[model samples]
Target: MLFIDPENTPDFKRSLFNAIVAPRPIGWISTMGPEGSVNLAPFSHFNLVSTAPPVVIFSCNAPADRHEKDSITNVRATGEFVTNLVTWELREPMNISSLDAPYGIDEFELAGLDKAPSRKVRPPRVACSPASMECKLLRIVQIEPQRPGDTVSNVVFGLVVGIHLDPAFVDPDGRFDVARTMPLTRLGGNQYASVGPLVDLARPSPRHD
Candidate 1:
């Protein structure tokens, strides 16, 4: 087995860190800037952290020079954003929105994506996504810079205020058929994967329960 200190490791292997943390859900985040400009970007480090209050978190990397990414900047400014679920059919547009463009450039128009007005937020949602969550900014936690010229991590937590789901992906039982949605996820460098065949695994219980 090979072992190397992550912080002091060579630059060549830094990307391996993401590759090691395989199959992360893509947070197709959309936010409106202070000037009403729209921005869209994808983050691989995203996940749902709670069920009761419906908390979701995604992290953005801020370079030492270019600190505070556009998403973070917009979220801080507007306190509202939308997380759109990426589907197999919408993958190209999703990737298109990830383009790094000049500030104030509208990604929706750049990517040729139709926008749907969110119920409780100023930011718009991608019309072609299988589902979307309108979120209110809860808080942003900025981690200390690891080293000189290194990127700082801006961890943003959002509370789900509204949700929209395409009826086609819903099951008769009133639940989302996630597999049918063909959700796309990141898998290390230059790789992506889609939801596979469904598997049902019941949780084991103790006799006392």
Candidate 2:
């Protein structure tokens, strides 16, 4: 077994960090700047943190230059953003939006995608997304820089204020058909995977004394 310390490994991020995490959900976040500019970006460091009052978080790691990403910058400025689910059908457009464009560039137009107005947020949802969550800013936490010139992680937490689900993906039992959505997930080194056959496992019965 190889024992490696990240702090001592200069190339750990590129060599092992993301690979070890395996497949992670992509948070296709959309936000509107204070001046009304729109921004869209994909973050692998995103996940649902709470179920009650639904809270989600996305972390943005700043470059060595310490430049804040547009997604976090816009969320801080407007206090509103949307998380659009990226399915296999919408993967290309999602990847296009991930381009490191200029601050004021509209990713929707850049990707040739239409935006649907969100009910509880200023930022719009991707028209073609299978689902979306309109969120209100809860807080922003800045992780301390690990070392001089090291990148900082800005974590943004939000409360899901509203959810939009495509009726076509809803089951007769009122469940959102996640398996049918075929959501895309990020792997290491520019790789991605799509949701496949799911395994159902039931919890074990409680023991009786």
TM-score for each model = 0.94, 0.95
Superpose all Cα atoms of candidate 2 onto the true structure and report the RMSD in Å to 1 decimal.
1.4
lDDT of each: 0.88, 0.90
88-108, model 2: which lDDT tens digit per residue? 888888899999887899999
Question: Residue 56 in candidate 2 has what lDDT?
Answer: 98
lDDT of 1 by residue, 55-167 (tens): 99999777444667888989999999999998877788888888878779988998999999999999999888889999999999988866654667889999999999999
lDDT of the structure predicted as candidate 1: 0.88
Poorest lDDT segment (10 consecutive residues) of candidate 2: 8-17
Candidate 2 regions exceeding 4 Å error are 64-66
Please report, as a residue range, the 10-residue window in candidate 1 with the lowest summed lDDT.
5-14
Clash pairs, candidate 1, are: none
